[model samples]
Target: MKQFTISQEHISTYPNPIILKKGEEVYYGKEDTEFPNWIFCKSISTRKSGWVPKQILSTPNNSGIAKVTKDYSAHELTVNQGQTVFGIENLNEWTYCKTQNGEFGWIPSYCLSST
Candidate 1:
């Protein structure tokens, strides 16, 4: 499975309550049929696994410029893995982005690739 780094600090909305930090790479776990948002993945650094929002992810080509990637952040309105986010401003480490739902927050710059 593909891995993505945390774009901002994420307090898993699921169990184990492990605090995920910005830049931590989490391996993709199995998808849940019941809840789409609370899917699980294991952490490479901490050796912990739990459900995370599908929005907080991006690929090498993660499309805002590319596909998104970074791991976690302390922003409110955290974007789900595959959600399309609009950049409000490009900060060096964290880029301020707004979700299509009109939610605003910070996503890590490493997550976005140059298109």
Candidate 2:
């Protein structure tokens, strides 16, 4: 696993994240203007809404509905500057990571530095 240091503090926004299984459907909303790679979506089954990375969402039609290409969790980890984490995956401009306490979530790539 790749090690990284948190270069900036990050606070998780969503307490209850949107969890989706592969092939699950979601109603697409709008793309985040600040984080263009993420789009707001609501799960069709759960009706839970959150910001989901566009990379995991299939192409939407005119009605703005799409299927999830893979299992995903819109979970973010809150970390202080200089904290260490292990990278699990990289998607859209974020990194999925596991912290020392065994908590796992996504952090913006810009806030991490290879250690």
Candidate 3:
């Protein structure tokens, strides 16, 4: 498990929950049936997708490019927070990805989103 700092004591009581600050950009995680995740900005009306991107943005990777070489649909790795299953070329096959920095490689869509 990794350690993270909480910005507010009011929200520290929750376990394994992603914290979001206003104006911060983050990734989406698994949907919480008990509590709605991402709150839509009503100023721009849009249909709810029942998912929330984490408010805490991840540190940008300084790698090159890579590709996803396997299938993990059976793992139930939905398009949640840190779930890097989106924007792929093949949903079930290997897909190529390029890092914003410079690294290039492939990863099982499932291996992502989580650790």
Best by lDDT: 2
| Tens digit of per-residue lDDT, candidate 3, span 1-115 | 2211212121112222222234433222343444333222111122112223222223322431111122211111212233222223323332333333332333333344322
Give a tens-digit lDDT track for model 2, residues 16-107: 99999999999988999987889999999999999998988889988889999998898999999999999999977889999999998999
Could you give me the TM-score of model 1 versus the true structure? Answer: 0.38
Greater-lDDT candidate between 1 and 2: 2
- Model 2 off-target regions past 4 Å? none
Model 1 C-alpha RMSD vs. true structure (Å) is: 13.9
Clashing pairs in 2: none
The prediction achieving the highest TM-score against the true structure is 2
Cα error, residue 93 of model 2, in Å, equals 1.7
Model 2, TM vs. native: 0.93
Model 1: lowest-lDDT 10 consecutive positions = 59-68
Would you list the C-alpha lDDT of every candidate in the order shown? 0.50, 0.93, 0.27
Model 1 stretches astray by more than 4 angstroms: 1-15, 60-115
- TM-score ranking, best first: 2, 1, 3
Over 1-115, each residue of candidate 1 has an lDDT whose tens digit, in order, gives 1123334343224333434665566666556676444346666677666655556643312322111145443343444444556666654344666666665555555564432
